[model samples]
Target chain A: MVPISYYLILAAVLFSIGVLSFLLKRNVVTVFMSIELMLNAVNLTFVAFAHRWQAVSPQAVSGQIFVFFVMVVAAAEAAVGLAIIISIFRTRQTLNIDQINLMKN
Target chain B: MQLALFIIFAALAVAGALNFLLQRHPINSALSLVVVMLSLAVLYWSLGAEFLAAAQVIVYSGAVMVLFVFVVMLLNAGEEERTTGSRAAYFAGIPGAAAVFCLLSFVFLSESKTLGSSNLGGYLNDGTVNIVEISKILFTRLLLPFEVTSILILVAILGAVVLARKEPDPKVVTSSTDAAGVIVIKEKV
Candidate 1:
């Protein structure tokens, strides 16, 4: 059996990678992707804990339920997020996050 | 057996990430992310999170990724010009990545020591876990978050619609049907 710790560690690593990517990448779309990666990492950890504890004593399905909800939010986020990205491109002719300096000042 | 499957899924996820990082085209990166999501689904399945695995595939691979791809296509995001930051900033990422790895290792080691093996009650009853029991506990305990999630989805939809709406031309909307139609204005090349 693969230990639950393994999954948790993997999730943490993936989340960190996502964070790093989000920081390093200058493209708006890539940053959006990095955010998705971070969310998925959280879902992985949630499911890992749920699987581990659910077998022993049936306390609650908190983790699994959380994952479900996160997925729902992610879907809605993607829908609106991409639409906005397209609109931004239409207006600015650029998809670079760095070029979005108007919001900074 | 299970460990092998876990390793395979992990490899797939990592590979997808690597590909996404290196790929030039935005659309390709979006597609690779879909692969990563599928591998996560498999991982969830192996962990006995059947419902979660299914939802992962359906919600992520099916819905979110498609939207991502659509945006990539619609924006026509090409290779971006790489701006070299200062040498200090470039080198800083190395230590940052290492620090993150160490933190993850520490958490995993500590958690493994504290978590004890619990008896697999009804999950092992019929060689498959009961989905009903899972839902019951979810609805009962995590009901508030569940409702909030729905609201969040609604907000995302509304935000996307609002953001994507073009600056309406007063002359363009002559009718109700035209009002609903989105005018795709071509950026002056």
Candidate 2:
């Protein structure tokens, strides 16, 4: 038997790495990728909790349902975000966030 | 056996994430993320989330990642120029992340008592019944959100087309449309 806590802790570690990567990376696409990583980490936690609660709330399945909504939103976000990135690249000719700062001046 | 599977796949997932982060080329990072997503799907399957595991692969790795790779190719996104950072960030970032990991581990480990140990296939309700119940709640309880998400996808499609369209010069539009028609004619040829 694998402890649910192991999954929870693994999710936390992945989340932390996502945060770290988001902070460290300068490429806009990589940053977006990091955000996806964080989203997956959260999904892991949701599934673990869903498994734990299945015995208690057999009918609700709220945790798994939450994961479904998250996946949907993520797909939408990816489509929109990539399109936005394409436009930004068209205008700015760069994918580096450090150079895309227009409002800073 | 279950524990071994968990450990192996979890390690693969975390390693993939790290490789994604460390890789400089956007394409490389994108591929690494594919790896991470695949391993995560396996992990989801282990957790008895059969539908979710399948969905993760189709939506996340297949669709989302293809989108990412397409954008990378379209934009010709180059390798990021490596720059030296503030000493403070490197020195502080590692330790700070470590501290947070330790803290979270402590909390999760302590709370493990309530979560209990889960065996593989512990969620072995009737497979068909599982899908039926999920669909029941999805169509009934969560129906509104589901409908809204379809609308959201439609809006996103529109937004992508709008955002990616070339500037609206009337002559350019006509010329491009004519060129697009030529493309179709050429395709048939």
Candidate 3:
């Protein structure tokens, strides 16, 4: 049997990397991808805990179910986020985050 | 055996995530993200979340990332210019992150003996937790949140369409007379 800690450690490592990218990357899309990475890391942790809790109760599958909703919400967020990114790119004529400073122009 | 499988996939996932972060072009980052998602799906399967594994692949890798790639192409998102932030941040940033990673891993290792020490082959012992069971629980207990999610997606679609579309010409608005009885001259293009 594989230890649950191994999965958790992996998630933690992945999440730290996600944070690093989120802070370091300049392109809005790259930063956005890092957010996805962070979400994936969280999903891994949830599944690990879900696996551990499977022995206790009837609601053994709750973690998995939550992961389902997280994915749905991520999809919606990506749609709106990318649309905003594209809109910014159109008006500002640049995808660089430093340039898109105006609130309404 | 389970340890081996987990190690391999986890390594792949981390490598993919690194590639996504390091790549300059948005397209390359998007592709690496796909790799990360696929490996995570495999990890979910190993954890016996069969339905979640499938959903992770289908929705995240298939749909969400495809949208990312689409927008990357549509916007012509180019390589990120290296920001010349303070020299102190560039020097301290990575080491700071490494410190955080070390701290977190230290905590995880300390807890490993208590939390991680579970027997393998749990799925073989416990009857399969399949799609039907997940759906049964979801439809009954989680019904409201599911409905709310549907509405959220609908709003996202509307918002995306509205935000991305070009606005009507300002000259067209000028053609109509104002209520204050002011003469609004229609400029000839």
Give the residue spans of candidate 1 off by over 4 A: B85-94, B116-124, B127-130, B170-189
Ranking by lDDT: 2, 3, 1
Clashing pairs in 1: A80-B160
Judge the docking of candidate 2 as incorrect, acceptable, medium or high: medium
Off by over 4 Å in 3: A103-105, B85-96, B118-128, B172-187
Candidate 3: Cα lDDT at A28: 89
Q: Candidate 2 residues B1-189, lDDT tens each?
A: 999999999999889888987899999999988988898898888887878888999999999999999888888889998764445556787788778888989999999898898757546565543556668889997899989999999999999888888885544222223644653322211
- Among these predictions, the greatest DockQ belongs to 3
Clashing pairs in 3: A1-B120
Q: Candidate 3 lDDT, tens digit per residue, A1-105?
A: 788888888898898888888778778888898899999999999988888887455347778788888888898999889888887887778877666668646
By TM-score, the better pick of 2 and 3 is 3
Instruction: Judge candidate 2 at residue A69 and give its lDDT.
Output: 92
**C-alpha lDDT values of all predictions:** 0.76, 0.85, 0.83
- lDDT tens digits, residues B22-78, model 1? 776778878888988899998887766778888888889888888788777777678
Question: Which ten residues in a row are the worst by lDDT in model 3 chain B?
Answer: B117-126
Cα lDDT, model 1, residue B140: 81
All candidates' TM-scores? 0.84, 0.88, 0.89
